[model samples]
Target: MGRSLVRHPGVRGCYTAGNKRFLQLNELDELRMDVYENVKLYKEWTKQWHDSKITRKEIIVGDKVLLFNSRFQLFPRNLRSRWSGPFEVVTVFPYGSFELKNNKGECLKVNGHRVKYFYEGQPIQARGELELEDLPSLWDE
Candidate 1:
């Protein structure tokens, strides 16, 4: 059910079959859901997460985090470009997600599942130089 292919180009996000919570997420497809789930949880709970285990906001104006460009984008990440750096939390939308910043500190709004904490071992990157550089750019500035 899981296998790391060499990665063929033009393969957008993924193609999942069913909704199996206990499904074997062995291949990258399985992990893809994880990314989706993490961001989703963040999206729904940004308010309650302000000072809780959320640690980071979904996409506030000034929080620092990461963003995964959709496979459909012109410069979308492949096996090589799938992951980007720690972006800033530019603005949090009423819908739940937030605007994000890239390594260059540019604003790019994204959903919760589309982004992560920015750290190793953890799905997204943890806060560090990446987030700090872009934090000041968050909303209400």
Candidate 2:
């Protein structure tokens, strides 16, 4: 009865089958590790590419700049301007911070990223003089 129970299909034994399964498990582990390493490398490359695209703004004291209006984002207006300053830069601090002075003589500290340089346009030249009758009266009878 014991001899009949020990029948084999091929020349390989039970030990060889167990050994092959062990080797396959080790190969699978190595493949998983390789995939993890490739993912990490891809993440680092993407971060470097994204960081390179950002442009750094150079700000200095006494420069005129416009402050970005973040409050307007909540109440959207198509015709309104989002930037609201020709503020003077009173002082510049380290790590992209600036102290700005508005027209009302009020000074506030803000991040440099929120501000951009304001470019002044050319002044308008008067073509001709107007008579007193042409001027609109402020008071009406």
Clashes of each: 23, 0
Report the C-alpha lDDT of model 2 over 17-101, residue by residue, as the tens digit.
5566766887999999999999999999999999999988877888999998877365688998889999999999999999999
**Which candidate ranks first by lDDT, i.e. highest?**
2
Clashing residue pairs in candidate 2, if any? none
Candidate 2 overall lDDT versus native: 0.86
Question: lDDT of all predictions, in order shown?
Answer: 0.64, 0.86
On residues 1-141, what C-alpha lDDT tens digit does candidate 1 reach at each position? 553334336776543444232245446686898899999998878957664764544334655566675666666445675657777676677766777767776776566777767653646767645666666666666
TM, every model: 0.34, 0.64
lDDT of 2 at 53: 100
List residue ranges in candidate 2 displaced over 4 A. 1-28, 72-74, 123-141
Q: Candidate 1, 130: how far from true, in Å? A: 32
